[model samples]
Target: MISAQSLTKRFGSLTAVDAVSFEVGTGGVLGFIGPNGAGKTTTMRMLTGFLPASGGKAVVAGHDVFDEPMQVRRKVGYLPETPPLYRELSIGDYLRFVAEIRGIAARDRARRVGEVMEQVGLSGWERRIVGSLSKGYRQRVGLAQAIMHDPPVLILDEPTSGLDPAQVAGMRDFVRELANDRTVILSTHILSEVELLCPRVVMIAGGKKVADGTLDEVRHRATGGVRYRVELKGEPPDAIAPAVGALPQVDQVKPVPRPPGDGPHDPWDQGFRVLDVRAADDPRTAIARLATEQGWTLRGMERRVPGLEEAFLAIIGAEQ
Candidate 1:
């Protein structure tokens, strides 16, 4: 539904976005993440046709963002980081204005406005003045206005920024619900939001595309190797490390000391005697069989995939 090829943007002497490229499929949610001054907003603006790229190309819903900007705008709904709102207007009036500006038919505009308001949890508050609404409700009003046209692609910048915890959770759920049938590309620095709502992520640093993939795929690429935590009973971890390490797939096996207060009554159950295992391929089956033959009871074994936080740290740290 969205594609960009070496998209670049410049402002005077500075290049705001540098040769970034990615794609978002129908019904996909792509989280655009980066630190301050990382060009996430610039990329989104180019994709939405609000800002033209200085080089390369971007297409939205099969229309070239530069050449067919009007068509792209018609198919895309955008909410900037700071929403463009009419503070003095009532919520209903503001949305109606947006619908009309987007060229919605007069007959269908009211129905569409009501539906979007309800979808964003602003139903009964339409009569309330936009200026009088709280931050959360104003955000809802912004969301309602964005979707009032029922565009196929939605681009939101910091959709949950500046909200309290409760408001953030509400906004997160709202974004998830919005992505049911439409493509969404949202820019945020919040890793937790990406973890909860996005299946794939595109990370930018120093105006360049640094990482792009599913959460686990990006994490794995950033971490450089796969890791696992293994536990065993009856035999001390030291007794099995060499055997496990000898497997063709195994790379390194380092014993993790048990936490304090763990006792020998049921040593494995007492606490996790973790074996930090790294490998070229999965070795759990081999390790399990070896444990059984050695009269050692298998307690637990699980892969430890890197999280988004770790992946972000690694990617940005390297760029610095």
Candidate 2:
């Protein structure tokens, strides 16, 4: 488990992280996201004891980050945006070094190193020099080192950065697997990856906490409310908007603009109009019934949940 209570970090007159607070349960991934320069890395550093907080407090695995830094470090596995690696050392030597420093017993170091290497898909890479590996392989090595001691908490900053599409997918799967037993704070710029891996999300912007909740809750808050897409073809295009808007279940309705060059006379256009309807509850059934009663041909109607990217922009854009 992890908790940040108004965690604040400052550099001279500038505040890198301003009283940001959130929590991650004992077992699951919590997506930590923000725009560039939003203080994501700063916050992670403070949580992992790599940087001291200028104000507020953080607790990791039930130990106060400030009071018991060594205990926190022992419980937390940190993978910064750039993996901390010694290029001159081969993968085996580097991980073995990490295992020893992390307090692994000398006799158990080899097995732990091998298990982590295999977990990160670097099983046979023991002899390869870390400096010679590609970006993807380097990331794997970084992850291997982070999990070498099998810490209960993982603070990963941009773990998939610089990885190709296939590598990104692989990393996502591995992170998901890791979340089975550990509490993970996953910070990344990739919103889609967060959507797939993190059921809960905490978004920061302008060095302050902007949003934090279950994925659906944050998206719903960012978008203002739930939405539905309704398409229909009928006699007076003007009547549809007013009729839908007048429905008690509908809070608002806006017509979707026709595509450019889509003329009224075009047969393919079918004189259909699309409306984005916003409401607190499902209105598709009512809308469909109304269309039938009004002799209008209902083309399609479906609920539309805003994507994480859309929600992210809406929240960050508002902060600006």
Candidate 3:
């Protein structure tokens, strides 16, 4: 449903989106993420034909973004970071206007507007003034507008930026429902949202495409190998780190931050410390051997999978 090939956008000497490309098939949800000023907006604009790319090509719902902008616009529903709304207009009036602009037939505009408003939980809100609506309601109106035409693709930027937990959950559920048969590009800073909503992710930084893959693929690619969390009680507490570090198979050791209830006055908790060990190469056997030889009381040792947030930091941090 969406394709981008080396899409590049430049403003004077500044490159906003540089040779970036990715594809989202019909019914796919892709998480587009990056830090602020990372050109996510510029890229989305190019995809929506709101901004022209300097080089390369993009196709939305089978229409070339550069050559067939009108057709592309007709098939794409874009909700930008800020809800584009006319405060003076009532919700019903605003959505009707949107339906008209989206080319809904004159006779069908009212029914379409009402359906979309209801789909986005804006039922009975048509009489409410746009300016009088709360931020969450404004967002609902924005979403209603985007879907008024029932476009095949939805590009949402920070769709849940500001809302109570309940509102955020509602938005997430709505987006998921929308993606049942439509392509969606969800751009947000919330990694957890991506984790829940997107199976694939495309991350960009400094106008360059940094990573693109399923969440797990990107994580494993970033961290290189598996990590393990080891909690042990051993003699000479001060030598714990060195003892673990001396193991030939251990590549690196990181201290695990103490969690709540770890500082209680319990005798069993004495002389125990937790550490994260990054294996040099399959160090599980070596870890067990070292612990047994040293008479260390092994409380727990579990292999760990790197999360998206950890991978995000690793990839973004490396660019810095």
Best by TM-score: 2
| Candidate 1: residue 79 Cα off by (Å) | 0.8
Cα error, residue 148 of model 3, in Å, equals 1.0
Native-structure RMSD, model 2? 2.4
* TM-score for each candidate, following the candidate numbering: 0.82, 0.92, 0.86
Q: How does model 2 fare in lDDT? A: 0.92
Q: Which parts of model 3 have CA positions greater than 4 angstroms off?
A: 233-275, 279-294
TM-score of candidate 2 against the unseen true structure = 0.92
- Looking at model 3, the pairs that clash are none
Q: Give residue 85's lDDT in candidate 3 (0 to 100).
A: 98
Per-residue lDDT over 80-179 for candidate 2, one digit per residue giving the tens place of the 0 to 100 score: 9999999999999999999999999999989999888888988888999999999999999889888888899999999988999999999999999999
Task: Choose 1 or 3, whichever is better by TM-score.
Answer: 3
The ten-residue window of minimal lDDT in model 3 covers: 262-271
Model 1, 121-198: lDDT tens digits are 887887888899888888888888788888999999998988899999999888888899899999999998999999
Write the number of the candidate with greater lDDT, choosing between 2 and 3.
2
Span of 10 residues, lowest total lDDT, candidate 2: 259-268
